[model samples]
Target: MAGLPQSSTYVSLTTFRRTGEAVPTPVWAAPDGDRLVVWTRADSGKVKRLRHTARVTVAPCDVRGRTTDEPVEATAVLLEPHEWRQARAALARRYGWQWRVSYASSKLWQRVTRPGIQRHAMIRVRPA
Candidate 1:
C-alpha cells in the first residue's frame, strides 16, 4: 500500500428508531481529527433518527480482522454545505469512494439537493 492513501477504514455506526425497534447500519467512513464524517441522502432514516439523538459510536477496523459489535462511544452532528464539500474531497482522497446517488444526478438531482430530503444532513461523529 505504498502509493495508496494512508487512512483508517472505519465502520461507522449509525442508528434509527423504527416503529417499535432500533435500526443500525454500518458504513465505510473517513476520519478527520476527532471528527468522523459520512455523506448520505437527507431523506435517509439515519438522518431522521440522528436529529432525535446526536449520540453515536465509531470504530476503526483492526488489522487482524477483528471487530466488536459494540463501538467506541461518541457524539455526532450534521455537516453544512461547505464543510460537506471538504469532507467529500477528503473521503475521495482517502478511500476513492463515491456516492452512487448524487445531488448532481439527472434522475433526481433536485430531490437529492433539497433542503432536507437529500441535502439536509451530514454525519459527524465525535469522541464521547
Candidate 2:
C-alpha cells in the first residue's frame, strides 16, 4: 500500500450510493501509518454510505474536489469511539495551527448557533 505524497493536503473521497451512484467529497486527510484518516460529521452522507459499504475511491484533489491525480481504490472503515481522540490529535498534528484555530472556531460557533450538535467521527482509508 503506497502512501500519498507527504505534501498532499486534500483528497477526493468517493463513496457509492445504494443505487450505485458515485458521490465525491473533498476532505482533509492525513497519513496514519499505512492508512489515511479523515474527520467528518457523524451524520454525514458519506458516513451513512460507508455503513452500507466500505468500497471507496480516493484521489489527490484541490479543496473543491477537482481531482489532480488518478483515483486509487480503497476501503474505508469508521473508527471506534475510543479511537476518535487519537485521530483528532493526528489531524491536529498534520494540519498544524490551522486545525487548532478551525477546531476552536467550530466549537465556538456550534455552541453559539447550535448547542449540543457537535457529533464527529473519524474514517480510516486503506488502499485496496
Candidate 3:
C-alpha cells in the first residue's frame, strides 16, 4: 500500500465493533516501514474494539474525522509497552514539538479529570 500524502497531518482511523459497525476517529499518523503508527489512550474505544478485531480502515482526513482521501483496508495491531515507547519516539521525531506538547497536555488533562486513566498505547495499522 502507498504511504499517506506528505501533507496530511491527520488520518481517519476506522475500527469495527463485534457487530461490524465502524467507529471512525481522526488521529495523528506517522509512517513506520510498511505500516502507519498512531498513539492513543489505552482505554479508548478504538483500542477496545481492536482487542476484539484487528481489521481497520485508514484515510487522510481533517481533525473532524472527515475523509480527504479514499480509505485503505488494513489490520491494526496493538503494540506492547516497549514497542509503544519506540512508536512514541518515532512520532515525536516526525511531528517534533507538536507531538510532545499534545502528549503532555493530554497527560495533564487526564490526570486532572480522569485521575486514574490508563496509559496510552501505540497502534500499527498495516495494509490488509
Tens digit of lDDT per residue, candidate 3, span 1-128? 66543347899999999999999999998877767889988989999999999999889999898898888889999998767777887788779999999989988988988888657888988888
Better of 1 and 2 by lDDT: 2
- Model 1 residue runs over 4 Å out of place are 1-10, 16-22, 60-70, 97-120
Q: State candidate 1's TM-score.
A: 0.64
After TM-score superposition, the amount by which residue 26's alpha carbon in candidate 1 deviates from its true location, in angstroms, is 1.4
lDDT of each: 0.59, 0.86, 0.86
Q: Which residue pairs overlap in candidate 1's backbone?
A: 42-118, 43-117
In candidate 2 the C-alpha lDDT for residue 82 amounts to 87
The per-prediction CA RMSD against the true structure, in angstroms, equals 6.6, 2.0, 2.4
Better of 1 and 3 by lDDT: 3
Residue pairs in candidate 3 whose N, alpha carbon or C atoms collide under 3 angstroms: none
Deviation in angstroms for 50 in model 1?
0.8
Q: Give lDDT tens digits, candidate 1, residues 1-128.
A: 11111245656464646443545565656666656677666787878778788766555445442444445666668787777877776566656624433434522665555534434456777677
